[model samples]
Structures are given as C-alpha cells and as structure tokens.
Target: MQQTEFAFVLPQGYVDPEGNIHREGVMRLATAYDEITPMRDPRVQRNPGYLVIILLSRVITQLGSLEQVNTKMIEGLFSGDLLYLQDFYQRINQNGHSRLRVACPHCEGEFEVETVPVGE
Candidate 1:
C-alpha cells in the first residue's frame, strides 16, 4: 500500500492566542467517507464554504504542539495556510501522489518533482 499521510509546513503558520506559532503538521489522505460525511454536516449545508473546514479537521491529525486538531483551530489558520492545505489535500488524495512534472527553465529538462503545499 502507498503512504496515506503527508507532512506539510505552513507558509504563514497559525498563531495561537498564547503566541505559539504552528508551522509543521500532518494530513492524512481523505477517504470517500471523509468527503461524503462533511457534506451532511449542518454547517456545510448552511454554508458550502464550511465544507473545507470540516473536511480538513477530519484529516489533519496534528499541527505543531496542539493537543487536538479541530474546526476551530483550522478556522484560525491564515489564508495562505488554508490554501496550502486545500491543495495538499487534492494532491495527495485526488492525484494519489504529491509529485508533478516540471521543466527546467534554463535547460528545458523535464523531470518529476515532489510538490510542496506552500507556494514559493
């Protein structure tokens, strides 16, 4: 079986009320149930945008020194971090891999490179 979980470093990071900065985290590949269950959530039904929050809360197993990952914590994330997580989720689960084809600008050499969720 392939790896089901992926590690990520947030670009902006999440700052808690105590001023703790959380950058490193782990996210597991979402299952069919993981995607479906969130749709039934009242919050998602009320606001479709909230689906990402619920979906992420279910897959994010860890975030820095946080004891538990929850929707509240996810909601506190910076926009960049949230975007990173969204892309990361798709890359790992939808693509079934975290790699993409790229070409070197200078030499035009094509190669496969592991993708980082955060943008440069």
Candidate 2:
C-alpha cells in the first residue's frame, strides 16, 4: 500500500528549550482509533482545546531533529503553528490532500492551489 504520510512546515516553528527550531515534520492520516481514543483522555474532558494537541501528537511521526513527538512537544508549539497543523490534519485526513480552491480577481479564473503552511 502507498504511504499516507504528508510533510509540512510550521508557520512558526517549535522552539525547544535548547533553542533549536523545528520547522518541518511528517503527519500520517489519522486512523479511527487515533480520533476515538483521545476522547477518553481526562485532559480532553477538562480542556476541549487540548483535543487538537492530543490528535496532532498521535499523528505526527517526526518533527525536525526531535527524538520523539509527544503531547508536551505539541503543547510547546506556537499558536500559529498549532493552528496550521490542525488545518493540515483536517485537509489530509478528511479531504485527502492539501489543495484548496482559489479564484483570480482580474480574470475571474478559478484554480486549485496546493497549500503549504509556512512562515511569511
């Protein structure tokens, strides 16, 4: 079977305690268990916002030079990066691609753009 992993660059990379910036990472398509299991976590019950953290931690296979991807690391990501990852996760798992529809203002032409979340 083909790999379902997708690569992404964070809008604002995660800065570790050692000051290392982690920008690029890989996230796999979320399995049924990946989505359902987190609902049982007490943290998700306490803070609904934390659902994204747990979801991303489970899907992200690698993050730059990090030895492991875990909830603590996901928690450390900048808000922008977190939002980017959430969108990315939905695009890959739900839509199966990062392409988004776009329209040209001048000619009114419609097209699709493959979005990559990255810093300006």
Candidate 3:
C-alpha cells in the first residue's frame, strides 16, 4: 500500500466572520487556551500535510522548543474573530514542489507566487 500522509493548509485569515472552528471547522484550529490568531485564507488550506508539518517545525526551531510550537500554533488558531498570515505555500499541479501564493484573507487580493519544494 502507498504510504498515506496527512497534509495541512495554512490560511492567511479566517474565511467566514461567524464561522466557528471549534464546531463547523474547516481547519483543525487550536484550543481556546491559546492566544495566537487564526488565518482565514482558503488557499493556504490547499497546501500539503508535510508542508504544514515542515512549516510548523521551522516555527518550532525558532521557538527553541517543541511544546511552545504547538502552544503558539493553537494560540494563533483560537484567538480573534479572524487572523491572518502573510507567507504560505501550496503543492503545484503536476509537480513535487509548492507554488507560493500571496493573498489576504479579508481582501482576497492576489499577488506573486513562488514555487518551492518540501524537505529541502
């Protein structure tokens, strides 16, 4: 059997203003105990699971602790009516690399995209 992996997507902000991630969830957000904000962009959700893991790992590296990483992620996800992230990546069609797209969750503006591979 092919090894199936879980892919996670990062949004620039919350898509719905009234959307409750704890109940009718699009992304698995953090618990209510954290303080970080949620990103609402839909495109970030298009990224692969490994990319998500890698992204968070880099965050963990910066934080200098694994526990803090999860705490920060969840905090960002649970806080605010909506949140936003500037940088994000997605898997490119017919390719192993990711296509970088920049957009605001609130404005839905499109910007330049960059292609980068995972596990680099």
Estimate every model's Cα lDDT from 0 to 1.
0.90, 0.89, 0.31
Give the local distance difference test score of model 2. 0.89
Q: Any idea how many clashes model 2 has?
A: 0
Candidate 3 lDDT tens digits, 1-120: 421222333333223235423212122122222112222324335653333443433332222112233423433552331221112212321222234468978999987665332212
Model 2 per-residue lDDT tens digits across residues 3-63: 5998899877989999999999999999999999999999999998888899999999999
Over 4 Å off, model 1: 104-109, 117-120
Report clashes for each candidate as comma-separated counts: 0, 0, 10
Worst 10 residues of 1 by lDDT: 111-120
Candidate 2, residue 69: Cα displacement in angstroms equals 0.5
Error of 1 at 40 (Å): 1.2
Ranking by TM-score: 1, 2, 3
Compared with the true structure, model 1 gives a TM-score of 0.89
Model 3: residues >4 Å from true position, as ranges? Answer: 1-68, 77-95, 100-120
